[model samples]
Each structure stands twice: as C-alpha cells, then as structure tokens.
Target: MDENTAFPGASDESKAEYILSNVAEVVERILTFVPTKSLLKMTCVCKLWRNCARRVLRVQQNMTWVSASGPSNCDGHALCPKLADEVENIYILPKTVLVMVDSETFNGQDCCYKQKKARKSHHGPDSIEELNGLFPKGCDIMGVATPGIVLTPTGSHSGAPKEFQEGEAGYAIMFPRMEGVDIRPFHFCKNTISEANLVEAGLVNNTDLRVVLLFGYDAFKPGAARFLNQVLEPLARSKVLIAGGHVENVFSPKRKCCDRGSYGVVGLTLSGPKIQGASVLLEQDVSSAKAAEAIIQRLKAANLPERNTLGFMFACVGRGHNYYNNQRNVEADTFRKVFPNIPLFGFFGNGEIGCDRIVKEDYNLCDMDSDGLQHGYTTVMTLVHLG
Candidate 1:
C-alpha cells in the first residue's frame, strides 16, 4: 500500500517514523504490566527504537533472579547437551558465563568463552563493528564486550583487572548480564590499598556503595585478614554488606566446580534505589550443631523490612558435608529454613570477605557492633532484597 493511503499528508520517511513510534508506544504500555524482575530483562529493543521513543518507552526495574545452569562439558557437549543448549543466546541480554574445569580440559586461555556462539541478534548490534560508539568516553575495555542493557546507557566494561595475570584452570566470561543490575567495579593490587585507592574505586568514602562482592586469592590467610583490618576496620561502623570468598587452591578427588585465576583481589560495589541488602557472619570454633544453632539464633533475632530475594554464602571448604557428619548442605539448608524459597548461591573457600548487619524493622537499627571480618573457618552470608 502507498504511504498516502495509510498515513495521509505524510512523506515516506515520516510514515516510517510514525509506524515505528506507534510500535514503541504499544511496547511502552506493555512494559508497565510486566513483573519487576521480568521487566529488567526486557531491553529497549535496540538503539534505533530507543532513540525514536527516546524517553517515552524507557523501562526501569530490578533483577531479582538470574538463571544459572550447567557444569556442561563443552568439549563433547556429551555430558550436558541440555545445559549447553540452555546458554544459547535466545534472550538477547548479555550473560556472565563461568567455566571452571581442569587445565587438561580447558587450557585456561581462549576456550573460556568458546560456548558463546555468535548468532544474528535482531535488536542488538547487527555486527561487532557497530559496537564502537555506544560506550562513552574513558569507558575503555581491555577485552571483547557486547553492549547490552546493563541498567544504564553506559558501558559495563568486561575483562579482568590489569593486575591479574595468566589466571588458569578456570576463567569467568562476564557478559553484561550479571547478578547485579546496579553496580561498580573496584580492584586491590600488589598489597596496596588505602583510603585514596578505596575512594577512587568507589568502594569507600562514597554514599553509593552499599553492598560489595569481593574475591581474594591467597594460599595463606594474610590477604583476607589484611583486608578486614585495613579496609573494614576503618569502616567498621559503616553498614556495608560484604559477600565473596578468599579463593584457595582446592584439589578434591571428586571435583565439583573449580576456578583457577591469578586474580589477586577484586570487588564489585553494589548500589541503586532498587537494591537492599542484609548479611550475617557465623563462626565455626564449636561443633557443627552448635554453630548451626548460633546462625539460627542470630538470623532469627534480626529483623528485615523487605523479603530476601537472593543470597550469597562465602563459606570455608572445611565446613561442608564431612564437617557436618556426612550431611550435605547443612549451612545452606539452615539458611533456607529462615528465609524459605530465597535463591542462594556461593562457594567454599579458605576465607571469606563477608559480614552481616540485621536492622530493626521499625527502628531500622543495626543490632550488632561486630566487625565484619572474613577469615578461614567462618561462614559469611549475604541476603539481597530487590525493590
């Protein structure tokens, strides 16, 4: 049909614009009806439609849950063909692909992102060549990246910190999609961390940093210990929900999940209007049963305003099934009882970068004056509330 018949008094270009604008208008109305968690996964469609509507069709929502699948054997696709297929880029949103296998299987090099088969994305950049101008100035990235809706128009720089070298056995391909919707990255290198560095990284001396995801690598316990003394000691009074592990080399006869990276120490500071967090630290000096009792008491006594949507537990490798007298998921199972049905994920390592501060419901007051220290032989848990 001619443009004159459909859109009278409009030129060809104008008619095209009118049709696109109407399409965007319909999508905008649909967005308001979508659940908050699902709404976050829905992007602006593309840069073209994004510009056409500009502000009208933009949607704002928080990420409550992220689908995590696999232990897939990518080499053969024989072990987990279904899991391998799960990660196929059907959603169009970027996903953080974490692959941890032995050096024999995956050489800790280029194969980390081998599974992310590039197919034509209808709404995203048509080609890798077109990703040039989307990221703003000073937002340079070291490795490859895809521009996706990471809760902002700005770029979520993908790659390891410059300090990390030849990290092997395991690698994490952090696509734009992460557990965090609103977040910032920070690094601590060569045992050098101060107020200045913290400020520059948006870790400390800022109102924005509320929750943090940290990873510390050391054979001994000094790295995590020093972090707590130097970093958390100063901000001992400040309420920061810290969650992460002090990564140690684990050699198990029955290997579960493994990651090997020379990643010294890294963190992601989380903050946004939609993010609310709570945390707890449980010591394991006593018997497993007693420790579980303590965790129950502390968590139950504490009050939280919003329901916990997700959880992260950074626990000691020593405190698992063997420690719990052949009982699997004792710690995790304990957590589930308190905040039932809340999605939780974490790892077992030598040390943890974690703590908890339960606030009063009406007063919104912190209950304990405990310093959030992460050392070996303790369990640190962080529960997330997404508004």
Candidate 2:
C-alpha cells in the first residue's frame, strides 16, 4: 500500500472523506498530546481537516464562579470574628464550600492541596497522567492528560497551579476552573493563548460562530467603554453581517411602576452597529420599573424582525442576587420583559468577547483591546440565539 495511493474501490470524494476523518481522529488524540496553539497549526494540513479540528479546540460552554461563606468556629463566640469581618465587607459567603484545613492556614498558599495529595497518593496513583484519563471521551475541554485543578477567581485566595507543564513538550498550561458553580471554566492566560485563543489561532472562525457572548466584571467604569468598543467595533464592521445585525437582536424589559424599595436597577445598552435601528433607553434616576418599561417600548419601536431568538444570556455573577438577597431580580426580569418566552442562560464573566468592528465607522488595523475591564456591582446582559 503506497502512502500516496488511494484505497481500492474508493472514489475521490470517499478517499478525501477518509483522509479528513482520519485527520480528525488524529487531532482528537493529539489534543491530549500537545498544547492548543500547536493543534491549530496542524489544520493547514488540509482544508477539511482544519475546519473540523477547529471546533474540537474552541471553548463551547460559558463558565461562572460563585462565592459563599459558612459559619466558622471561635474559642468563645458562636461566630468567628475573623470570618464575620470578612463577610461584613463582601456581604457574601467567603467560602464556596466547606474546607477541612489546618487552623494554621497561610495567606498565599492553598492548604487544601496538601490534603488532596495525601488522599490521592494513599488511594489511587494520583498524577497528571491519571487525571487526564478521567476526562470522558468526546467531551470538550481538550481532553488533555493533566491533573485538573479548579480555581476560584474572586476569592481572597485564588486557586490554580502556580505553573504546570505538558508532558515532555515543556509547554506551560493554565487550567482555570470555577469552584462554586456548575458552569465550565475556560481558562486563558495573559495572552499566552494556548487552547483558548479563538481569533488568531483559528480554532473557531467567525463564520462558524452563530452568537457572540459578552460578560463584564464587577463594576462598570466609564473607562471600560474603550474595551467594549474594541470588541463591538469589529463585529459592526464585519463583511459577514451578524444574525440580528444590531437591529433585530435588541430587547427591553417592562418596568414596574409600584415602589420596590432598594431594588437593584437594570438598564440595557444595545449600542454600536449590532442594533440596526434599535435605540437604547439611557434613562437615569428612574425606578427599576421605569427603566425596564422604556427598554421594552424602544425595542418594539425599532421595527426589527421577530424570530425565535434566545438560548443564552450574559451577565456579571455579582450583579444578580448571588451578591444580594433577591433571586432572579434584575437580570432575570429584564430578559423576560424583552423576549417574553425565550430561554435565557448566561454566566457572570470576568471579561466579555464580541467583534471589534464598529459598523458605519471607518478604521484601520483593528487591534485587540482590553479597555472594558470592570469590577463590582454591574450586569451586562446579552440574549443568545441557540441555532
């Protein structure tokens, strides 16, 4: 059997399909063997191979981290003053789960690692090789063979490996996990861009992308406008017009006129070229009801197509009652007002991703920007269309 020769009794299309399928299978195995950045380069072997392999490398799900604290023991008091003081400022549980650790805990070190190692070594042979085998086949997340370490992002003590290297390749891999919730954590280093680099790495192309999800950090600073614009400007100016193209996708919730004291206010800002003719209701000092009402009215006024558009929502984890006493208060209600009956699911993201192309605007060399950095008490929501 010659390496260049086609299989007997097979047409060109069948032979090509066989080659492409073999490449995909090989790529799947290679995900465990190499880093994501390297895997994308293999796509150049062939067109069909690149397209299918790309999907295997991209982050398919959104992840969220929730923080909570439990009662701690003190020598004399029912509540530990140390934990009480910490909760007083944050007003949420500092510990997401019950941690059995020594009283002598260090500030920089996660004492849990010691306990985890002890448990693993005494039972199963615990190593990165063993951990990687635990990943279910065909499930996304690179299926890389490594000891999985989940981390908490907004904790006094963040949890993640200080450094981890892949087998023999010596390339460092950063695995980010959300400790408190079910949402899958998609870890990305500071532009190290291994498996998570979507754009330049060519993992998931814009043509395959049906929706662009966005999530902001804690507080929305005026300065973040630049970062938000960076992602939005490019999409607005894309040759491949977005599904809603800005106009059809915008929505506004109905406002409640009655007094709901101290209730958090949610305002929708559907700006840039994404919303074709849609106008945002930028009303300040208004009650939650008024703001929501204005949004709905404006959504109808935009005169866009009404389709079955919804599958996911993007909001900050801190914005919803995860930080307050009210559940599904502002975020859940806002989506209901606009879409009425579409399913809404999203996570509170540390940062958001959208196109930097701003429609109807002239620009050159659209470089990536992180100007949308924010922290504390803000919710940026987006309605996703799950094809």
Candidate 3:
C-alpha cells in the first residue's frame, strides 16, 4: 500500500487528528498565499483532512448581517461551493420580498410617469412634495430621504416603507441620518421587537465591545438612524471613527468631526488601541489579500486588552460573480488571512446597511423600499473587535 493511503479500519478521529496536524503545518507554512477554495478541496482528499477543515471552518467568534438571502440555487450552484456542501446554519433572505429593477426603469423618459401622475392627483400635495419642500431651497435638489418615496431626476419610484436619497448623478447610494422606519418587523420596543433592539440587548449582557462593526442589509430607516446615531454619537465624539460603505460627499461636512468614512457598503470601526500605528486600507484601496494583511498586521502590532477577539460580518448584494469571481469569495480570502482562527459567518443581502450618519452625496432616504430594495451588485462587510 502507498504511504499516503490509510488502512481500511482507521478510525475517523485518528484520521482527523493526523490530518489536522499536517494541516496546521500547512497553515503555518503558506498562511499568506493559501486560497480558501483550495483549502476546502484538500480536506476531501482523506478522512483526516476532512476533520482539520471542519475545525478551521468552525466559527469561534462571528458577526453576521441581521437579515440576508441565501443563494438562489445552493443545491447545485457554486455561489460558495466550497462551504456550500458543509454549511448548515446558512441564513437566506425570503425570496418574495426582494425585487430587481432594470436599468431602463431608472433612465427611460416615461419611467416616472406613474409617480408624477400620482402626485398631481393628491389634493394636499403628495408625500414627495412635502419631503422635497423640506430640502433647502435652490440647493440643486439632489434626492429625497423619506419613508415611502425615493425620487430622483432620472426617475421617481415608490416602494412602501421609506426612501433614502441617491445623490446627484446617481454616482453614490447614501443612507441619510434619520429616525428608524416604523415598519412592524423592525418595530423597536422594550420586548426586543427588532434586530437593533436585540443587538442592543445583547450588548448589555456582554461588555466586551471594543471595536463594533455594524452590517446593514440596507440603509438605516430614519428612526433606526436616530437610535444608532444617538447610541454611537458618544463613541464618535470620543474619537472612535465610524467607517465602511460609501457616502463620502454626504459625510464631507463632518469629515474632521471624526476619523474617516470612505468605504462603500460596510462600516468598520476599530478601537484606539487597534488603530495605533497601524496603516489604514480603505475597502476600495486593496484586494482581499492586502486587506487581510492589513488586518493581521494591525492586530499583531497592537497589544489589545485581555479577552480581545476580532469579529467580522458582511451583507452581500444579490449581484452575480462578475466583480471578482464572487463577493463572498473575496470576503473569505480576507478572513483566512486576518483571523484564521477566529469564527465567521454571514449571508447575501438585498440592501447593505452601514453607519447611521448620512454623507453629503450619499443616496437619499427616498429610495428605501417598504420591504427594503435589493441592488444586484453590492456587498457590506463588518468587523468587530471583541474582548
């Protein structure tokens, strides 16, 4: 028999231990260049390899989006084929609620006819009128952030719950600083009626929140923003810069007021110690590999307090694998580098949510959907430092 093949009666536990020992060495040797997909396949080569892979995949600490949709077809497709066959706790968004609008809907001339007509029919001026009137007069009138309508010059659309303005030229999508929506599913009550409430509640019991990362499935409802802003305002005031997701122009006014806000769909806030002497990498500035390297160097460079652990979460858009094979793949690559031993989990989303504050050129509140809008090509990832 070959030296590689094991005897027929070898136990799974023994095989796993053997594989884990070798895998650990491999991780130590090629930790920098190892690809997660390749790592998964290597596990299938033997019973021992399978065991080591499971241990590596098991999440010890994690941050996940509150709401997300699973792959449209996970049984056969490869959205996350490596982990596809092994993951059991995957969270998927309900199929009925998310909808996709063609680019024509936003650019065609007749696209907003129905919306404009509805406004004319209203006797006391429609909600859109009321919201638009709120904007500073002669302000070039970009977009509106409201609860039921998101009107842009290109097109005016109505969902149901709320809307956030998409700034001028539609160059950016922004989440305005406003109160959370009054939707039932997201209603905030003392009994923990909403996801935010649950997060807040969880925070109370565990006081180890040094670096907090908030992953949004979509923009913050006006009400939700109010709560988050108020809660996090203190942190920002204390020099804890809130970042992630893209809303540069909207946040320009307050740029000097905090750390930085230049990412596109996710917000990452590291503690002061975590940021000490560590170089910064805006999401747009680097690929997953470099991002991972930045994270590892930062963590290793800083001498964090006891019990500190890094956590990450991401809200993926329904977009296809065009950007770079797949958004999740990019995410996984970063994970392998920064916190190889840490736990991680998340799901694809309809809309990404980030910080509660609104930037100048970000999407207005008008575009938010009652059921939440789904953009095909967007992703939001969050990383938290847990102690």
Clashes of each: 3, 31, 57
Per-residue lDDT of 292-323 in model 3, one digit per residue for the tens? 45644443443333222322233333322334
For residues 201-277, write the lDDT of model 2, one tens digit per residue. Answer: 22233433222322222113344354334344544444322211110000011123312121111111222232222
Taken over the whole model, the C-alpha lDDT of each candidate is: 0.44, 0.29, 0.28
Candidate 2: worst-modelled 10 consecutive residues by lDDT:
244-253
lDDT of 1 by residue, 1-387 (tens): 865777878788987666655676665665555532344444455654444332322323223212222233343211123323333322223222222222222211221121122232221121111222222233321121111101100112111111101111222222233333455555554445778887777776765456666665443434545454555554455556667665432111111122333224555666654456667777766347657766755655654433435456666766666577876666666666665645455556656666556422232434332244556677777666644
Estimate the TM-score for candidate 3: 0.29
Q: Please give the RMSD of candidate 3 to the true structure.
A: 19.0
Candidate order by lDDT, decreasing, is 1, 2, 3
Candidate with best lDDT:
1
Which candidate's TM-score is highest? 1
Error of 2 at 241 (Å): 10
Model 2, C-alpha of 276: deviation from truth (Å): 12
